[model samples]
Target: MALTGAASAPPRLAPGGVVTRADALLAALRAAAPDPARLPRDAGALLGERAALAGLRRNGRIAAGGRARLLCAADGWIAVQLARPDDVALLPAWLEVDPARFEGDPWPALAAAVRDRAAVPLVARARWMGLPAAAAGGGSAEGGAPGMDAKPPLAEARRAGDAPPSAAEARPADGAPPRVEAPPALRVTQAGTPRRRHAGPWRVLDLSSLWAGPLATHLLAGLGARVAKVESTARPDGARRGPAAFFDLLQAGKESVALDFRAPAGREQLRRLVAWADLVVESARPRALAQLGLDAEALLAEHPGLSWLSITGYGRPEPGGGWVAFGDDAAVAGGLVARDDDGAPLFCGDAIADPLAGLHAAWAALGALRAGGGRLLDVSLAGVAAEAAAGGVDPRACVVADAGGARVLCAGRSARVAEPRARRPAGRARDLGADTTALLREARA
Candidate 1:
């Protein structure tokens, strides 16, 4: 009954002309499910990239609009994310200028500074400081150098005090090379022995944020998993600051555990909680998790049946892991960006990567869970976007129109999708730290 009455309803969004491949995605999930009946029939009902984005907007959109956008640097374009207050505070360091120079808004000064600087060094430095910044048009940030086909994984997050892997020594091991030099659409790696457990209740630790990861955990909740959303007191999920309804829509049935992730006690609690989990859902790059001592390999080895799903903007474990990206940029990375008549890229429907990745992650998790354990699913947003795009919009499902020299596509009959109701169990959502004490005791016990 984890999610029986937990899900109320998603706000109705006027169909955006842009169509989502929701049907294809859902079909793929259903096909992959080892036990289809274990999944809610309406799994696709609450899905749609645009609908998810609409849930996050304020009045009409985010008050902090353009917090993550492509900025014009002196030599090229760079994507900088100033989503959190800490990120805002790091701008002065990123720009190497006075924080008060912008008065209150950092946009103008940031624009000027970025305009006067080159993208590469600015991106590298921003990442070195643990701030979200990346080069646009396939430029590299922390993980790999510019123009590389795949992002190489960094052994550790290249924060201000950390060291990045040396280019000379970061070579593929001697023997057979990777199957693909470029990121693969889907990659599944597992270790240890598989042990299947069919039970009435399962435990999941959700360490991801934003749409995709949250949506995956949400689906698991509907599937009868007892999901505990693990957040850091220092930086809770950004969704909390967005409209409440949207937050509730995806998080209604999950418990919240806000711990000081960096502190000794918090870290101890995290270890216990993770050890107690049947599955761990996270969207961090491998290095980020390494920094927190949650080594996937070690964890899988320690807990033979533990299934860990690592979500990234690109693939993980090397050549793609360390790279930086977000939902929109990852979709663009996947080549779904709308283009003008001149073939210039235009923004597509609401951060499409988020929802697509979410669905894919949920399906992957279910498969891993069904397989029993010792499964590590590395899901990349860009890779998923590429996977969805590889299917392409069915020509029969769309129509093209030309406007002022710009070409656009509109959804047709094939795009008219529906969300049918299912008998999901009733459940409740918890507030920040609502179950910390009880969970800590359980973990310890």
Candidate 2:
């Protein structure tokens, strides 16, 4: 058996909350399903969306602590994500959908059918683009997992480093007339296709090196998008060696294009791809993209509907914005490093912030697209690490020290708790004192 997606299935019910995959899936399936009066066209859209949602939700609550809603097209290709900033684990699964299946205008009935087939329950009233109620199993109403959350079509058709598309292909989804006016900033464009709409597949220009940045486009690849992972031969991706760990994990469904963006021609070629991209994601430091001539303003002027994401250690224009730093786990442990009285530093065991922040960038990009809103996503590793510790106390504050001893720190606090044995009781000492007194008197005589 394929071990139905749940690992140690969460309890059917939890207190201070109502979380049950079965119920949420079932409810979403029922609500999003089209009625003759509502959806009018194909019901299959709803079904497919529901099925994909069930699969994405199956992983249950991830360590970052949030649930995700999967948007699917009839062909089993997931189109978008409705995950919150905290739900980072959903990216991999989201990236797995085929691009050929995206529907810019999704069918309500089809989404419902998919839900029914997957046996996923739904929580009612989830709506997007005037669509019916829908819900991913664990999302809550207000935000975060255990609540309400909001939430790809692909076309391959292209390998990495393909020549960029013409100006027409780079237009935004705003339906505005093309403008000939030039802007002071970099020249750019954006494009966004809605669910259930039969739009041609697109290529992604990925200007990220490591796990967090490239991971977004890697996901885009899984859904049938052609992701050209842009790298520089001068600065190779860290994943190329680090256990070759993230290379496969992040680039699973994508192709790579190593380019020297620092060179003049590289910028022109990149602009061609930018003109061709429906979306662009970067893990560069703040203003770094602009230096390379790929900032949001430049891109949006040419392609207004384009969705852009900027994943970073801190944030652009914020304190420490451009300062390069470690991923979430490393930064957190380093920031909170608790030195023993001996002055030795200790760190946490997980590298959590990178992936969590990466996933948030991915989810936000998709959400903005679905809503037809183009904006820059400023995701920070430190911010995400802080979120992981939410609702919990700081460990350092309550730490207890041990008493001085030969015991190794491994013994923990036992050195402090132990007390030395007391001297013999007064009664036993009295006899010894009397003997001493008699000896003294004899000597005197």
TM-score of each: 0.70, 0.43
lDDT per residue as tens, model 2, 1-445: 0111122432111111111222332343334333312211222222122123223222222211122223322221111223223122222222223433333322342344343221111110011011111112221211111211111000133222333232123222442211111101111123333222125554466777655666556444534555556666576665564433225545544545555668997676667666656667777765667788776755665565566677665445432243344442222311211122232212211233454455455555555555553555666654443443222222222223333422212223422212111111112111112222332232234
Best by TM-score: 1
- With candidate 2 superimposed using the best TM-score fit, by how many Å does residue 293's alpha carbon deviate from the native? 2.3
Task: Estimate, for each residue in 372-445, the C-alpha lDDT of model 1 and write its tens digit.
Answer: 87888888877665555443233333222233321223453212223222333343357898999998888787
| Alpha-carbon RMSD to native, per candidate | 9.2, 30.6
Q: Which stretches of candidate 2 lie over 4 Å from their true place?
A: 1-198, 328-346, 393-445
lDDT of each: 0.60, 0.36
Model 2's lDDT to the true fold? 0.36
lDDT at position 374, candidate 2:
50
